[model samples]
Target: MTTAARQPIVNDDMHDIITHVNEGHVPELLHCVKAYTPVQDATHVQMTAVYEDGMELEVTAPAGLSRHFVAYAVPGPAHEAIRGTVGEAMKKLGVKPDSRVAHWCLTENRALTAHFRRLTVNLGEDERADWRPGYACRFDVPGHEHGRPYTLRRVSGTTAEVDVYCHDNTLGSQWAEGLQPGETVTARGDYQEVTPDFSAGPALLLGDETALPTIAALLEGWADEHPVRVLLEVGDAADQRYLDDVHLPAGAHVSWLPRTGGSGTALREVLDALETPPAAVWGALEVSAAKALRKHLRTEYPDADVRVTGYWRVNEKN
Candidate 1:
């Protein structure tokens, strides 16, 4: 790696202050690293190398420890870039990058409805076996160069189930639709748990179909003493059947809204009818609806902890 040495532009007085600051408080040093951009590499480069404009990594393998160099497309922060580069390098070396990368065999794939499909996968007996609620995995499918993320709906021992919505046959959707039993897929994760803090008081959960898995996870940790309310919007009445087998909290009330045309009209109406502000509000929905919900929560219940994430953008191709 080649680093250009440049002198600081600070004058004597400023330099003196900076030196004093550094005497006892040194700024954290970032380790320089590099990662190849996804969907671009066609051929694998040799690991043993030295590049003028790249990062050199010390890799440990079964054979022995060796040095590998991966070039970066652009130069910037090292800490932010190293992990991804290391992950890709590990993949090339046919090794699991970390606990986040797991091998899963597809055990079952069945259509739940015309729009939804239920998939069950058998996991390995490693760190990935300790699956938790609210954790999602990203699938690196064969043809889909850029992976896709899916939330796990259920996990039992070495088995996990994922509910996939297949309304459109995009790259990710197409790969999911054709998945067969015994087929293997790489699952990587940056697990997220966005459930509201119930310790604040009673909670209100609101979202659409995409939020079902997350909502189910939140319900698993539900307490009977605290009141909980769920407001969900679905395409039709058929979509509500999945809730029949779910374990809801005691005193929990669920209201289902069927979308006629508008995005968040039902959610707005539901909020307007609330007798008291909830302790916290959590939701994931379409972009416009999520924005509207955030605005409403900020204006009406300013003191409440509100989280609204836009899962899909309107008329925007991801």
Candidate 2:
């Protein structure tokens, strides 16, 4: 287990890059630092937060403290074009990247249903053990440039599991379909506080299939006095039935909202019309839905604690 700590700036190139970035020459800096591909090794940093100026990451290649900014104006969304920065850094250090991105090999892969696969990875002896529950890891399969965030289902020892919802014409679906043991894939985790804070009171867990694993973690170790309700949107009857199999905490009630094509539109509508707001809300949904819900919740229940994120974006051209 790698102990995460804050180390003084050891990489000189990193300091130089930050120096140029401070001069408001981010585009110029990117032109010089851009890598043709993601630089992979036995370890890499996981992005934790994004902002207009730069992004924050949890460095695993050399595990360190919480999050720190790598100065540069993000060209687009937080997840877009991040590898180039990481790759440039690794390359300058003369580290022969092992895989263009830090990756974990599959230890176990099982089918939960037609559309969901339970994938597991052993973090190995070299990986960090300070991982918390309720967060997600972005996975990138070989030959796929874009990555998708999959919630960490469970972690035991050095192994962790994630439930991937596979749909046709998706990169994740293709990877899961042909998955085999010993094959390595990229996994990145961002900042999501797993330390339960029910200080606001009972929580309302909401979202689609992507939110299930995270919701389950939130229910664990919860006090019996705290009331929790889950409002989920799934594709069909089979998806709903699968949720029933998961053993949740006491007094946890799940309401299944079935959709025809497994879309977030229905769920978004319900959330928009929701009259009763909970003391706290946690959700992971599609990009549009997550943003809309967050805005509405903040506007309506300004005092209620909310932590909602867009687990993935839809209709992306690339």
Candidate 3:
């Protein structure tokens, strides 16, 4: 639970930083004093203190010595790189990152079905007491620049469970398949809620195998006030196990589409044949298919609230 006030500008860190800059970046400090402050006749400048929003400076002007502060272009309590485009987008928006990049050890690795493996990590008493429900985090994958995101399924005490389906040859799939007990994984920031509201009307959710975990998570917590239809396209029938334990509500139905022709073939056929347009649409699939399907949905159902994400692109590393 490190916060900006707690860890951003610690005394030891500040001392080291001040020493480094005073010794090396003196010219830059002088430039800052001249350009930023009202000290136009300043002769010499030295950095005195550093704050999260700005740096305090000791300016030597023609008149006398005075103190001034120069604000940082980007504020500190700065977060290092976060995984996934969602994190990048957050950074671009200047959203203060959640300081939760921590190590979680592999406690349990068991199979849920033919291709799905359930991984449980020990988050310890600190995390258990602080973790909020509906927060999903990204785990660091070895050799990958930005690791993949896994849906945090459930938490009991200090342990959290996440399911990884490994039927594909993706890097994340292999990484999950190779994980063993005692090994540690880095949990990146938790920014988004895995499940979104699809309780508006007769909503349509179309997803491929990659979206299985999120789809199941979404359905389990559904409001169940509206009619919902789920269409899942899987390369093999075994992937249906990804949703084996998901309980569908009274007005909810799931249809499994087999990949016969190619990606999105079955989904396209189904969408084209639908007589009544849905009020809302959500889909996660390969890049081209997701884009094309979004265009089709926008064209046909102009009034629908549609959201389609390119989970993965064809012929590209996952």
Candidate 4:
């Protein structure tokens, strides 16, 4: 039997191609650059970069696959540089300058990971105006479940505060842990969704940590004028202390419940306990809980003008 002559293996090292017989494909090397942009409600903008020319790219288009992109914001100077580099890379890929190609899904280029880490800020002692209680801040997070930035003012602590359920893994909780006092966060606009109209009537406000800031703001703005009833759900007893310490309007009746057993169980229990009809009702919480509360209120108190917001959704990052 004549054995077939063995074919020489072609190693494409110069082109950075690595191949495997079973895979039936070769990996190609490409160039990449780190770029960052500010998206509303994103504590720290995600950091992403562009790869070199002819580099195979996998992107999750709008209404497409789900994936994480590394994103972070930089100063004006660095932003300009990143934009230039990304432009050059896209030019090589034959993409138009104005194209929404930026939406193309690209992994956070690990090669520039060190640069991002170095850019992180640490607010050690300087008074962070943004973190102070009663300080107002706004964000513009589009496609965000909340859709709008309600007024937010710090309530319990000297820093800006937002409470999030451990189960609801959205950007708010992710950034809340790492948030520094002075760091800037983006919001949709200055438009106020529920500025307490003290003259409207007796008001009932309901929400969790996500709604706390707005609640605090409403209370502070209407303390001298409006009679408000506030109902809130918190993660645990620690959160209760935060609410207790805040100075609320004398007429404001505030109540709290722990959100542990289920998402909206605590809120539902509180709503069931209410005997008086509120002139207007407002609330914000995790999506499921908020939806549940909305449905219950609509069914039980049909006449009540209720505004319920899903501050964030579970498992969804944006």
Query: What would the TM-scores of all predictions be?
Result: 0.67, 0.64, 0.65, 0.46
In model 1, the runs with Cα more than 4 Å from the true position are 1-99, 315-318
Worst 10 residues of 2 by lDDT: 33-42
**Highest lDDT model number:** 3
Q: Tens digit of lDDT per residue, candidate 1, span 1-318?
A: 322232223332233223322232121101122233222222222222223345443444344544444564445444234334445555554554345678889998987765667889887665645686567778786676658777888888888888776666766668778999999867786456555567787788888887877887788767646688899888867878767668887888898998766666778887878866888888888878887787787678878777776766666654
In candidate 3, position 234 carries an lDDT of 84
Would you list the clashing residue pairs of candidate 3? none
Error of model 4, residue 52, in angstroms:
44
The TM-score of predicted model 3 comes to: 0.65
lDDT of 4: 0.45
For residue 67, model 2's alpha carbon misses the true position, in angstroms, by 20
Cα misplacement distance, residue 121 of candidate 3 (Å): 2.0
Better of 2 and 4 by lDDT: 2
> On a 0 to 100 scale, what is the lDDT of residue 92 in model 3?
44
Report how far residue 31 has shifted in candidate 1, in Å.
7.9
In model 1, what is the error at residue 51, expressed in angstroms?
A: 35
Clash total of candidate 1: 0
CA lDDT, candidate 2, residue 216: 71
**Judged by TM-score, which candidate is best?**
1
> For candidate 2, lDDT tens digit of each residue in 70-173?
64433543334354554565566565544423477798788887678888887775356766665566677666665776777777777877788888657777
